[model samples]
Target: MSNRAPLSNKEIKTRFEAALMGNYGLPAVPIASGSGVRVTDADGNVYLDMIGGIAVSTVGHGHPRYVEAIADQAAALAHTSNLYLHRGEVELAEKLLELVEARGKVFLCNSGTEANEAAVKLVLKAGKPYGRTKIVATENSFHGRSLGALAITGKAAIREPFAPFGVEAEFVPYGDARALAAAVDASTAAVFLEPTQGESGVHPATTDYLKAARRITSENGAALVLDEIQSGFGRTGAWFAHHAAAITPDVVTLAKGLAGGVPIGATIGVGKWGDVFGPGDHGSTFGGNPIACAAALAVIGVVEDEGLFENVLALGERLEANLADHPAVTEVRGKALWRGIGLAGADSAAVCDALAARGVLANPVRPDTIRIAPPLTITAEDVDLFCDILKDVLSTAPEGPNHE
Candidate 1:
């Protein structure tokens, strides 16, 4: 008998397209299960996932502690609306504050977009009564795809069609301190930016720039909001990427890896920003789902008790060092497990397909940029294998991604 399962990729795709929306079109394979950094397809082919669910799987797939936390939480008590409070929700919020080493208030939500939306609402509502209206964001920065987040998102192709974005926001060059300062004024409610630009190819914000934003926002009484959805939670060497800048922002949005793949997001407000919202301001139905909170708590515990931060630093150093010297790679940006690769003469899409063919999974975040956000728990051997496969894909290619 054959080792491969009876199911085929075409069969799965057909059924999936029939029942699901057209947004994702069709995935490469139907994943049945995953362990550590690898996933097994329905047809039983195993592939190493380097994207880590786009940076959502912090502790890797099917981590024992993460699994137990969700299972235990569900087995006990599951969903409770915001009208009612739960231990998991409270504890998760407290843990978030502790991890950042800042005094803040937290409102949990379902995803990264939702967290950005909530943060926007907090800013808009707070500023409305105070005569502040405009929000400042940087070019090439991606907050989320939701309406409000889309408004603040700096990508024109995605946001233009969805124009009349409802929110008043100004876009400036990402790293230019002067351009950013000029864009903000007394009427500006907030300045939203990513500590490291992930969607526009993993560009890191300079520490001086972060400090300037912090200083300008403080001087002008506008909120400085750092979108850490991708760079937070040990994805970077530190617990949070902004910690490297050694500056604090007014409001910080978090998601993606918060619950180690569980769907959860959080909007954290520091000091006065924390008190911006009052009763009946905002809420979420399945935001702080007990299972999600339990999962987040477990991820945090494991990250701390097991000293994953130190590992992230070491592994990040290794990944950057190994990939930077590649001839085809023009630049390596971002920190730790989250990185963006600038391809010299390869179609990132074709490279991704080639990687998939070679039993590795990654994403073409941009046409010329390949993003690798593997699980934090991935071993040194995994990094070596990924780099080796990528080098092979580049060398053996007949032409760029558009050709063979």
Candidate 2:
């Protein structure tokens, strides 16, 4: 390695602001490196990574096994496009099907949005024969930013600006079976749902609600699409959160933690819905690359071998129990490792910034909700540290929203 000095935070910020688009605005912290469940910023300030790259770092940063898989795959073969069949892709697809406990076909993509886009086409084609044109989604739900996926995303703030969304969709209140049943009718092509809504403050749909969706859609001949993009791959103590419902969905979308921080996504079509698309239907250039598939395989293997699911359950219980009756918290939402701590009168954003300053990373998902999804591989000690730091930060949390 060269003996040159590292870029200072100010220098890095200047170049980043000048070069990158303002879509994400300015990054609050400039991360330099990560290991296990912690990350160091540009100024060498270390913080426990509670959010884990927005729930994408499944096996944690720089895991030896995960890194080895990625490196080995890249050295052997990286990109083959979708033209040629690859082993990693096939194996990953088979493994996902086995975990879902259903016979299905998997369509690989590079992100959750692309997977949802493929889902749109699948539902559209599946419904074409029945003259069904409408889709149903839940209010406050976030699917993706792409035009096709945005059509079904019910959050009006991000979705409304790109109006004339092309697809016909109805919004229903999440966890309300009656509204979902009422919305999904003969003309409905599909009912898209998140088993646990992650982006809009980690709210999990009830088991009964999901079962109702399955039954209602089956009766009306509409596809039941579960967007497990944020909840899948053991984030919820299971391969997929919908597994708890014991009802097979027509389609399911996955990404985020699938490849443990590597960019990858998958749209799984179950049963008859699997055969919806044939040649020339849809495709992605970098979808299901060997490196991504290998990484996903490694993650699955590690999670299973190390019993990380059990770890998630144990640590989750401990963490939730500690925060349950805290004075600064109103309520805790979500299941297992995926959680949202609702603040009591305190502003979520301000609390998060305070926590960051004290060496912990979290996300203010909503004005009053602070979301924390730590790596499943975290130990009991790590959980305790998080709880202690969170309590300390809350003691001096800013009174309200930062007006400045």
Candidate 3:
């Protein structure tokens, strides 16, 4: 609306390097605008968005209903601190509980890390009365960047630098029932786990593993906290990835796709744990903003109305069948669109760059793994196009340095 001119990709990168922190590195692609599942970069190149803003764009980019809901909410009312209640927040919380199918309370926050922090407090407080202090998490599990969430995250590189996180945490091999059982004991206050590990490549836990975790934590009087930041909100073709296990965790932290890319996070405490957080224990100023809640409501409505779950299942089946049999792919892991493609011999990072150059966007979650978490709104044709592009890229990709 002003006299400012749009910056080109080079200019954007220059400014980014000059002003921003190097934590993420300068973005390879400077996206200018997006429509549906496609994004146009500052260089005027169009790309099929497979990453979905790292699995945050639930309803796809610029969805009509989602846009309208956000606009309407913003125009009507925006921020009202935690001092007074609003309909959007209350309705969103109620809807979350209903979808979770649990009788509990919802603590709204701004990000997955904050949600986990609230959960950490709840579990620690619950255990304080009984002298329980330890927390058990899974190896390679990614919760968030916050110190509290980082303390429970089992990855060494990111969590180690900030020593003395104040939270006593233990790590166990993911999906190992015996290891988990061995790690959790009377002194354990909580067990934090992801239904599907997304960052270190999307690896889903078996039903037996999750059920065993539930049993073990319950027996040890430890709160079973499921971090569904990336795996929840229909990413696994279910409302929650943990639903497949048929076990209700005491605490579930949700974010990412919760608000169709709008910043929102939720911590649901099931049963008695919901009442654990009393006055002044925890809160967020912009946690339950009406705009984000409205966006979330719209996303949920669109997902149900359009039957995206069935679409996700159908596309998942199609994608797995195609990718798993590809000559360049060794294996495909994960559920629905949240897939991690194991490259047979190609370097995943190089392959992703090639894919991007050819107009498809994906994530190299590991050196040999390509993770795709496309939006649910994409059509069958979109999947076919992605498959074709990926096939072309991988076919021409060079062998990785580690290739035998």
- The most accurate candidate by lDDT is 3
Sequence-dependent TM-score of model 2: 0.98
- In TM-score terms, candidate 3 sits at 0.98
Residue 348, candidate 2: C-alpha displacement in angstroms: 1.0
lDDT score, candidate 2, position 134:
94
Top candidate on TM-score is 3
Q: Model 3: runs farther than 4 Å from truth?
A: 1-3
Report the lDDT tens digits of candidate 3 across residue range 303-326: 999999999999999998777678
lDDT tens digits, residues 54-98, model 2? 889999999999999999999999999988989899999999999
User: Candidate 1 on 121-154: residue-level lDDT in tens?
Assistant: 9999889888898999999889999999999999
Model 1 lDDT, full chain set: 0.90
Which portions of model 1 show Cα errors greater than 4 Å? 1-7, 401-404
RMSD of every prediction: 2.8, 1.9, 1.1
Error of 2 at 15 (Å): 1.0
